[model samples]
Target: MRGDSLFGDLVRAHRRRLGMTQEELADRAGVSVRSIGKWEAGQVAAPRIGTLRALADAFTLTGDARDEFLTSSALDDITPAQLPLDPPVFTGRERELAQLSASGDGTIIRVVSGTAGVGKTTLAVRWAHRVRHRFPDGQLYVNLRGFGPTGPPLPPGDALRGLLDGLGVPPQRVPADVEARAALYRSALAGRRLLILLDNAADAEQVRPLLPGAPGCVVVVTSRDRLAGLAVTDGAQLLLLDVLGTDAARSLLARRIGADRVRAEPRAADEIATACAGLPLALAIVAARAAAHPAFTLAAVAAELRTSRLDVLAGPDPAADARAVFSWSYRKLRPAAARLFRLLGLHPGVASIDALASIAALPPDRVRALLAELVQANLVDEPQPGRFACHDLLRAYARDLSDRLDSPSSRREAVVRLLDHYLHTALAADRLLKPHRGLGPRRPATHAPGVTPTPLADSDDAMTWFGAEHPILPAVADLAEESGLHTYVWWLAWAVLTYHERRWDRRDWIRWQMRAVAAAERARDPHFQAVSHYNVGYALCELGDLAPAHGHLNTALAFYEKLGNLAGMAKVHLNLGIIARRRTDYTRAIDEAETALALYRKDSDPVGEARATNNIGWCYLTMGDYTRALDHCRRAVAVHEAAGNHMGAGHSWDSVGTAHLRLGNPTEAAACYRRSLAAFRSERDRQYEAIALAHLGDAEEAAGRPRAAHEAWHRSLAIFTEIDHPDAGEVRAKLASREVPPFSLRQQIDRRP
Candidate 1:
C-alpha cells in the first residue's frame, strides 16, 4: 500500500519489510548503495528499469508488490518519457506547436533555436505530448545536458546507449560503436512510428547522430545555437523562438496565479512580465513563488523579484536557475565577443553600431564583426538595422558579469566613451540642422574614430536622425552625471537643445535641460549653465509656466552678464520679451526686445538683431499701435531676408499681416498672411503653419469673405488638433460659432469682375 508517498519512501518502506539494508538492496539491484540512499532521501529519483527489475526480483515480491515497484520506479512500461512535467501555467507558442503536427510537410526534424531561457526544450516536449498518438510505437526524450552546470555534453555514443535502452535493446547486446548503435536505433524505430526530442544540444553534430533516420518518427532538437548545418545537410526544419509578446506573457502569468486574482490586479502581473522580460522560466519561477505563498499578492512578488532578480530566479535545481542557463551560453562565446557582451550591458539600451564600438574602444568595422558573432549565437538582436540590444534579463546577467569580469576603470572608461559618442555626434547633427549654430571646441582628445555619427545629408535627414536619438541623449547625459563625467553632463544636454526646440518635445526639453543646469553647477561652468537655463526657460515659456519660466530666464541673464557673453545675453533677452508678450505685459515686452536688439547689434549678429526687432513689432501689434508695428516688422523682414533666414522672415510677415488688419486694410492683411504660410510650409513648421492659417481666417472674416474664412479656420483647427496644440480649442470655438456663408468667395469676386 504505497499510496501517494514519494517513490524513494515507498522503496524504503517495502525494502525494510523484507529486512534489506542499503548494501543489500544495491547488491541485489546491481546499483551503488549511494544511489539507494539518495533515492530514499529524495535527493534523486528511482534507478533505471533494469535496476528496478533486479530489486523486484531480489525481494521475491508477489503481484501487488511487483506492480507497486514498477509504478513507483517510473518504469511501468519500456518506452522512456524523461520529458519533465510541464508547468501548469504553460502558454503561448501556439503557432510553433502547430507547425510540428503538420504531417504532410515532410519535416522529420525541427530545430527550435533561440537564446537561453527562450523555452526551446519546453516547446519540443509540449508538442511531443500533443502528437504522441501519431507515434503509436512510443515517445522518447533526453536532456543531452549540452549546455548546463554539468561537465561536458553527453557523447553521441552515450546518447545512443540511452536511446537503445529505451528502445528495449539489452545493455549487453547494445553496440559499442556510435555508428552501430545509431544504425540499430534507426532499425528498431523503423516502421514503428515513434517521437524523439533532443533537448539543449550544443550543435547539429550532437543532434545528427541521435536523429532517427526514418520517415514516420519526428525528431526535435533544441539549442541556443542556430544549428544552420542541420538545415543545410539534414533537411531539418528550423523553428526560431523569440520572447513572448506582451499579452501572451501576461496571460501566462494569469494562468499561474488564479485568473480572478490576476484580472483584479493586472498592473502587478504586467510588472512581473516586465521584470522577467517575457522569459517563461523566470515567469514560472515567480509563479512558483506565488503559489508557495498563496496569501502573497503579485505586487509583493514583483517587488521582491525586482530587488533580487538573479537570486529569486535561482531555485534549488541547476536547470531552473536563470543565471546558470545564461552562463552556459556565455561560456560558449569567443573571448572578444564575450567581452563586448559584458560591456554592452553597461550602455543604457539600444544603440547604433558606432556607439557600441565607442564603448568597446575598438574600430567600428572590427567591433561590427565581433557583434555579428553574438548575433549568430542568438545572444543579441538586431531589432532595427544598425541597432543592437540584448534581452532585458540577459542585460541584467551581463551587468552581473560586467561587475565581475571588467575592471572598475575599464567599466568607467567604457561609459565615458559612450557618453562622448552621443555628445559629440549629436552636436555634429544639430549643427548640420542649424548651420548658424556654433561648433564647440575641437573634439575631445579621448574620442575614438568610432564616436563619429552617420553623415547627415540635410535638414530632412537631420529630423529622422534626431527622432531616433532623442530618447538616448538624455539617458547618456544622466549616465555622465552618475559616472561623474561632469563635463559631458552639461555639454551633451546643451548640444541636444537645438533639436528639441524644433522637434517641440517640451517635456524632454525641460527635464533634460534642468539636469544640464544641475550638472553645469557641478562642473562650475557658468557659460554652459546659462545655456541650459536659457533653453529650459524657453521650453517652460512655451508650455505656459510663466513664473518658473521667468525665474530661470532671469538667472540665465545673470550668468551671461558675468561671462560677458553678448550673444547669450541677446538670446535670453529675446526669450524674456516672448514671455512678457505671452503674459500681456506689452510695455515690458517691448523694453526687453529693445535691450536684446542693442546687444545683438553690438555683437554684429544680424539674425539675433532681426529676432529682437520682430518681437518688438509683436508687442506693438498686441497694443493696437498699427503704424509702429508695421514699421518694426518691415525692418525685421528686411534684415531676415538679407540674412537668408526664411523662417524668421516668415514670422515677421505674419506680424505685418496682423498690423494691417488692425489698420482696417483687409486686402493687404490677406496678402501678408499668404506669404507667411508659404514660408512656414517651406520650413516644415507645422505648428507655425497652423498659427498662420488661424490668423488668415481672422483676416478673411474682417474682409467680409465668409467662405474663405470658413476654409482657413477649418484647416487651422485640424492641424492644431492633430499636433495636440492648446490653440486647438480656440480654433474649434471659432469654427463652431460661424454660420454658413451664402456664397463662395470666388462667386462674390466673380460678380464684382
Candidate 2:
C-alpha cells in the first residue's frame, strides 16, 4: 500500500460510497476483514491478484475502472493447474494419445468418446496431463459425472461456475443466471492459452455453455455418448476411442502385474486379454488378480476364464463382458477372499483395510491376506496403499453376487459390523483431533466378534486416518440410515465434523449433517435431532448461506430449549455467535458468546466455557479491541493447553498473536505465532499451519527480519499450494511485494532478502 496509494484510496472511497463496512467487503470478496482493513489503511504493499479481482467484482468495477484498479496493484492472474491426479498406471494408449496430440491445433475442441469403463475419461485426463505444458496459462478440468454412480451429470451452469472459479472469478462477480455466467466465463478465458478437459460429458448441451467462444483454448470432452452435436456444430475433432488392441491389452497387464509373468505365458496372456474383451478396466482387474497370485500361472487364470459362465468374452456391450470377466475372477477366489470381495460391494466408495477387516469379521492380518488374494484376482483395486476401491462395474457385480449368495441375515450382520467399525473408529479419531469436544462414553464389548476399531496414535495419526476415510464416512452413514441403525447415523456425522471443518469440505459437511438430521427424526431422538440440526446449521453458516443457516440454527435452539439440554443450548449459542459475527454484528457476537459461556458454566463444562471465551476474543479482535482480545485469547490458550487440546490452543494462540501484532508488539506476536505454528504442525492441520505461518511472516517482517519473513511465507505458500488453497495467491503476492521469489527455503534465505 505504500507503493500503491491510488489503489488504497480508490478501495476506501469505493467502500464508503457503497456504504460498506470492511467485514461486508471481506464476505463478498471471500477474504478476511483483517486483509480488507490492511488493504484500505495502506498497511499492505499490494492486494493479492485474487483479492484485486474479488474487489473489482465486489465494486462491480468495469472497463477502465477495473483495468486501473487491477494494473495499479500489478494484478497478474496466476495460471490454474486444475487437472486431477494423473492415472498412476496409464498404459496402452500410445496411438490414441498420439492421435490426440496430432489432432488439431491448440484452438480446437476434441471429443473422445467410448463405451463405459473403456477408459474414455482416463484417456482424456492422460492426454490433458501430457500436453499440459503447451497451454502455459493453465490446464482446467471438470468431471461432468455422466453415467457415474455418485450422481447425475453436472448442469452446464454449475460446470461454468467451476470453470470461472478455476479461472479465479470471484463468486460475487459470477452472474446469477446461467447465460450471463457463460458469457462471463467466455470473457474470462478469451485469449488465455489453456486446456479445458470436460470429463464424462452427458451430451453436447451440457458442454456448450462451458466452451470458450474464442479459440486460444483447447476443449477436450470425454463421454460414453458420441456427442455428435459438438462435432457437427462446433467442428470438434471426434476421436472414437475404441477398446485397446491385443498388444496394448497385454501390455497393460504386464505394466500392472509384471512383464516376465506375461512373457512366461504368452498364449495365456493373449487368452486372458481376449477374455477381457480388450477393455482396460477388465484387463486391470484381471491383471490385479494375476499379480496378487504371482505363483498362479497365467494359464490357470485363462483356464478359469474359459470355465466361467460366459461362453465368450465378445458381447454387444463391452461392460457386459467385463462383468463376466469380473465374475470369472470372483469364482476363482477362496471362500474368505470371495466373501470379502462381495462384502466390499456394500461400501459405496473407498474402503480402508480396517473397514474390510470389520466387514468380514476377520482380523486385520487375515483381511489383508484375503484382500491380497482378491487384489491378485483383480476383483478390487488398491488405488492408494491400504485403501481399496472396486471398479464401478465390479462393485455392481460384487453386490449382485452378494445378493444371490449371502443370506439376508448374514448381510445385515456384516453391515452392522462395518457400521460399528466406522462409527467407533471415527469417534476415536475425533477424540484425538478435538479433545475439548465431548465424546460418547465407550461401550465395552459391544462390537461383534472380529470387528475391531482402528486405534490412532495421536492427533497427527487422527488427521491421516480421517483424510483416508472421509470419502467412505457418508456412505457408511447412509448405510446406517438404510439399515435402521439410527444412532450410528448421527454419531458418525458428529465424528467427522472436526475433520470436515478443518479440511473445509463444506459440501460433504452439509450433506452428511442433513442426512444425520433425517436419521435422528426417524429414531425420534430429540437430543440427536437437535445436535444434527446444529451441525447442519454450523456447516451452512460457514458456507455463507446465512438465511437457511439461521433457520436450521433456530430449529436446533428450539429443540435444545425443549429438551432442557444445557450443554446443547450452549453449543447452539456459540454457533449463533458465529453467525452474528459473520454479519459484522460484534455486539451480538459477544452477547451470544457470553450466553454460551454462562450456559457452559451452568453445565459444568470447562471445555465449552473455554471455547466460548476464545470466540469472544476473536469477536473483540475483529472489532479492533486488541487489549480485550489479548486477555481473553490468553485465558483461552491457558485452558486449552491445560486440557492438552493442542488444536484449540493453536487457534487461540493465533488470536493472541494477532492481538499482539495489532498492539505493535511484533516480537511477542512472532513468539505466539511460532507456538501456534508448532501446535498446528503437531496436529497435522495443514490449513491452520499455513495460516500461522502467514501471520508469523507478517510479524517477522514487522520485526525487521525480512529473511525470516520470507522463509515463513515460502513454507506457508508450499502448504497452500499442496492443498490447492485460494490463499496461496495472497501468500504469493505477499512474497512478491517483498521481492522474494518462492524458491527453495535454503536457496532463497541463503541470498539476501
Candidate 3:
C-alpha cells in the first residue's frame, strides 16, 4: 500500500477504536470529514504532523495508540536516505536568498520565479529549508499546483483542507467556506513565528488565504511568472530566479557523485549538468540516478539524459522529475488557465500583454491577472520586466497541448485575430502619419472565429498602439506570410511602410515591401501588386539602388500597360521621372515626365495630371530651363489647389520658387517661397518648411536687403538644424558668409559691375 494509504488506515483504526464518529472526531481535530475518510481509507498517507497531533488529541489517546499514530505519520519510509534536502546546492543564489530572507519580519513573501526546470521550486525549497529554524513554531509547506500535464488545478477549498489538516485540524472541523477557514487558520497562528512555504502557488488569490496573520511568519513562494498583482496588491517581495551557473552545477555534481568520480569524468558530468540546463530538480534526479547505481558511470548517465531527459525525468517522484513536477503543477490549474497556456504557446513570437488580451478577447485587466496566474504556476517565465516567455521545451509541450485541445479552425481563428489586430493597428498609424492620403476601400469586417474586433477610439489611440507594437510588426508580417494571410500581409506591409518612411527606416521599408510584393503576387491582385512594386521601387530609389528600382518600376509599368491602366501607368512614369532627376539625368527625367503628363491628360485623372506636371517642373528646373519650370510649377499648383491637395500644392510652390531663384527674379521667388513655407507649415511638414526658409533667405539676399537676408538665413539655418537635415551643412556655410564684415556700398557696386 502507498505510504499515504497506510497512514490513513492507521488513523481509521485509531478513530474506530476510540468509538468516535468521523464528524465528531474531525470536529475535535479541526479538519474536514473528507480528509478523515481519505486518511482512514489509506488514500492519503501523509497527514501533516499537526493534523496527526489533532487526531491524537481528539481521540484523547494515551501511550501506544499515540506513539503508533505518530510513527505511522512520520515520512521515514518515504524519505529516501538523506532526503536530498540541499538538493544539489545551487550556486550564485546566495545573493537572491539573502535578499529574500532580509525582506523583513512583516509578511515576507518572496517569489522565486523562472521557466520550468530553471530551478524556481528547488531554490524556494532550499531557501525555505535554510530559514526553517527562524520560525520557532515550525514551518508549513504546500504545493498549490499551477501548471502540469494533468487536469485543472486543485480548488482553493481543497488546498485549504490540506493546510488546515497540516496545522493539526481534524477533517470535520475544517470549514467548507475557504475564507472562514483561512481566517481561523491565520488567527490560530497570529502570534507564532511560523514559516509558510507555498510552493508552486497559482496566484495571489490562491496564496492569499494561506497567508498567516502573524507578523513573525515568513512566506516564501516560487513561480515561473512575475506575479505583479501579488506585489502590487499584497506588498509581496518579488524575486525572479534564473538559471544556475556552470560552476554551481559542477559543484552540485561533485558533491552528489563524489569529487573523484566527477573529476575522472569531468567532461561527462559537465555535459549532464549542461543538459539539465541549470534546473536543480533535473540535476538532482540525474545525480540520484547515478548515486543509486554505482556501476553506472557519469558518462553513461549523461548520454542517457541527453538522449531523453524528459522521459528520464518523468519518474515516480514528481519532485525529482521535471515533467512529473510540471505535470503535477499542471493538474492543479483552472480550466481557463490551462486553455490560456495552450493558446499562448500557439503565438509565433513573444506576445505583448495587449496582444495577448486581444487574442483572448478578454478584458485587459482580467487577461493580465490570468497571465499572472500562469507565472505563479512555474509554467511561464518573466525573462524581462513585463514580458513573459516559456522555456523552449515548455513551449513545445504547450504547442502539442494546443494541437490536441484546440481544433484546426479554432487555432486558425486565433491566428487570424492576432494578424487582424496588427493589420488594423498599422492601418490606423498609416492614417495618422499621412492624413491627407485617400484611404483605400475598407474590406468587409470578417470576425475571426471566436474573436470580436476591438474598436479603436481615435487616431491617437491607434498611433499609441502602433508605437508600442512596432517592434513586433516584422514578426507579424512573417506570420501572415507563413499562415497564408495574403491580404493581411500586403495591407500590413503598406500600413507599416507609412511609419517606416516617416521615420526613415530604410531597411524595414525594404523588408516589408519584399514581403508585401510576395503576398500581393499570392493574392493575384493586379492593383495591389502594382502598388507593392511601386512602393518597393520607391524605397529602392531612396537607398540609391536605381538598378533594382528601375527593374521593379519597369515591371509595374508593364502590368499597368497590359491592363490599359493609363492612370497607374502615368503614376509609374512620374515616379521614374523623379528617380531620373535624382540621378541628374535631366533629359531622361523630362522625357518620362512628359510621357506621364500626356497619359494623365488622356486618362482625365486630375490627381495623376497634377503629379505629372509637378515632376515636369522639377525636371525642367534641374535642367536650368527656368522659364518652362516656372510655367509648369504654376500650373501644377493650380491643379493641386483645385483638387484640394495641400501637400502637392506645397511641393509645386517650392519648385516654382526654385525656378524663379535660378532665373534671377528675387521678388517672384520670395513670394513663391513664402507661399511654399506657409503651406508646408500648415501641413506640419517641418523638413519641407526648412527648405522653403533657405530659398526665401536666398531671394532676400538677391534683392539687396542684407539685414533682412541675414535674419531670414539665420531662421532658416535654425530650422534646418532643428530638423537634423543633411542640407544643414550648406545652410551653415551661408550663415558663416553672412557673418563676415560687409563691403561698403561703392565697393559692392564696383565688385558687382
Candidate 4:
C-alpha cells in the first residue's frame, strides 16, 4: 500500500509513523532540516542517491519497506515526455521555427499567435520535437482549450495543475491553491532544462501562472489572442504567424495527395492555394477532399472551393471547419468590433480608415479602436500602416455573417458609402495629377456625411496615392456598377485614366476604359459615353490596335458632334490625327490637326491650342516640309511653355528637334531633344522619357557622335524594357545593328487636349 505513494508522500508518512521530527530525521541522516522539509513538502521531485541512502539509514528501514522507498525514489529519475506525437506532416514556418530556436541564452518564453486554423499548435509541436534534446530534463505540453469546440477556456489554475502532473508531481502533492501550485511547479522545474509548451492558451492570464520562474526552462505559448500582456509583462517574444505562402501551400497539398498529381495540375494547385487563402487548415481540408476522391481532378476541387470557400473547407470535425473555427474568434469580439468585422467583408480590398469609417458611419478614431481589436484577434491585418486587409477566407466568412445579420438596406448603404469614399478621393487625387484636363464639372467641396476623401499633398502625393490604390480602383468600379451607382463607374474610370496613361500598363488602361464605356452606355449618358469611347480609343492607339482605335475615335467624334461639344470634338480630332500619323497618312494627319486647332481656338483653351499646334508640326515634319514644321513647332513650344504645360512643351520640343534633324541641323536637333528629355524627366513621365532619349540618340548619331548616341540609346532601351513598352524591340534592334534608323521616327503627337 505504501509503494503506491509518491516518494515525497512516502517520506512524510514514514517519518510521522516513526514519531520523529524533521530536525531529528535530518540529524540522523547527516543532512540539514531544510532538506528534510523540502522532501516532505514535495517541492523537490526526488532526493539525490546519497540523500536516499542517508534517509534509509536515518529511518532504519529494511526488506520490502526499504526496497519500496528506493524503488519509488528511482522512478522520479525517469524524464517526463508529455509532448504529443510530433506533427505528422508539418510544413512551412521555416522563419517562425528559426525564431523559436533563436530566442537567445536564458529562459525563453515565445508566444506563437495567429488567426484560427493558421497552424499555431502544429508549429509549436514541430519545433518542440526538434529542440527536445536541448531540454533534456523533459518536454511538457498542455492545450489550454482557448478557442476549442467544447468548453470555455481552461482556467489558469487547471492549466497549472495539468503542467504539474506532466512534471511528475503527484495529485496529492500538488497544491490546491493556484499560487501555491505555481510555486511547486517552478520548484519542480528549478535547475532542469525543460521545454514547457502551453498550447492554445486563452490569454496571458491563462499562461502566466504556468511559467517557471527558473532560468533553465523554455516556455512556448500558442494562442489566437495576441497575448500582448504576456509579451509586455513577462518579456515574451512573439511570433505572429500568417497563412502559408504559395510554394509552401502547394507543397502541403502535394504531400497530402501525391506530388505527381499536383505537378500534373499545377494551375489547379495554384487555384486551390489562392482559394484556400494560404490558410494551412483550409489547405489541409482541400488536400483531404482531393485525397479522398482520387477520381476528382484538382480543377474540380478548385472549382468547388471557389464557389463555396468556407463550405468546401469544412471538415467532419467541427474544430477544423473554417466557419466554425472563425466563429469562435468572432464570438469573442465586442459588439462594435464584431459589426465592423462583418462590414469589412463588403470592402473588396485593403481599406483605409476613412473608408471604413464611412461604411460603418463611425468616426476615424472609433473605427481605429475597433480595428485594433480585430487586429489583436487576428481577424484583420494592417497590411500597411493605416490600411487594413482581411484574409480571403475570413472575408468570405465575414460576408456570410453580414448577409445573415445585417439588413439588405444597411449593406447597400455601406456599399454606397464605400463607393463615395473611393470616388471622391480618386477625383481629388486626379485633380492634382491633371489640373488642366477637366473631363466634366468640378467636384463640390461638400461630401455626404461620414464620407471623407483622402487629402493629397501635391502631384507627387497624388501619384503616390494612385500607385498604392490603382489595383483596387477597378474592383471598386465593379462594386459601384453592382450597387447600381452607374455614374460612379465612368467617373471612377475617368479618375484613374490620367494615372494609367502616364504609367506603362496600356492593357489595364484599355480594360478599365472599356468598362467605363459599358457603364456609360447602360446609364444612357452620351457625354460620358463619348468621353469613355475617346479614352478607349487613345489607349488602343498606344497599344498599336489602330483599327479599333480609329473606330472608337469616330464613334466619340460622332457623339461629340451631335452634342455640339466643341471642346470634346477638339480632343477627338487630336487623337484622330495621331492615329492618322501612325498609319502614315500625313495629309489626313494635318487636316485633323488643323480641325482640332480651330476648335481649340473657338473654345478659348490655350492648353488644347498648343497641343493641336504641336500635332500639326509633327505631321508637317513627317511629310518632309521641314521649314513649315520648324515654324509651327517653335510656336507650339512657346505656347506650351507660356501655358505652363511641361508635357506639351516637351512634345513640341521633340517635334522641333525632328524638324531640325530633317533640315540637316544635327547640333540644333540635339539641343531640342535634350530640352525635351529634361521636361519629361521633370514630370516623371517615364514612358515619354524613354522616347525622348531615343530621339536624342538619333540626333547624336546624326551629329557624328557615335559614343554619345550609343549611351543615349542604352539608357532609352533600359527604360523601355523596364516599362514593358512595345518599342523596346525597336530600341534593341538599333543597339544590335549599331546604327540609327533614318529620321523616319516621328515624335508621338498629343492624344489628349
What C-alpha lDDT values do all the predictions have?
0.81, 0.81, 0.73, 0.86
Model 3, 64-142: lDDT tens digits are: 8788877655432121111126654555578877887685647677777666666776677777778666666677777
Error of 2 at 447 (Å): 2.0
Better of 3 and 4 by lDDT: 4
After the best TM-score superposition of candidate 2, give how far the Cα of residue 642 lies from its true spot, in angstroms: 1.8
Model 1, position 103, has a per-residue lDDT of 63
User: Comparing 1 and 3 by TM-score, which wins?
Assistant: 1
Model 1 gets an lDDT of 0.81
- Give one digit per residue, the lDDT tens place, for model 4 in 34-114: 866766766545544566777887888899888887766742465889998998887778888899999576788999999
Q: Which model scores highest in TM-score?
A: 4
Best by lDDT: 4
C-alpha TM-scores of all predictions: 0.78, 0.56, 0.65, 0.86
Judged by lDDT against the true structure, how good is candidate 4? Answer: 0.86
Using TM-score, rank the candidates from best to worst. Answer: 4, 1, 3, 2
Better of 1 and 2 by TM-score: 1
Inter-residue clash pairs, candidate 1: none
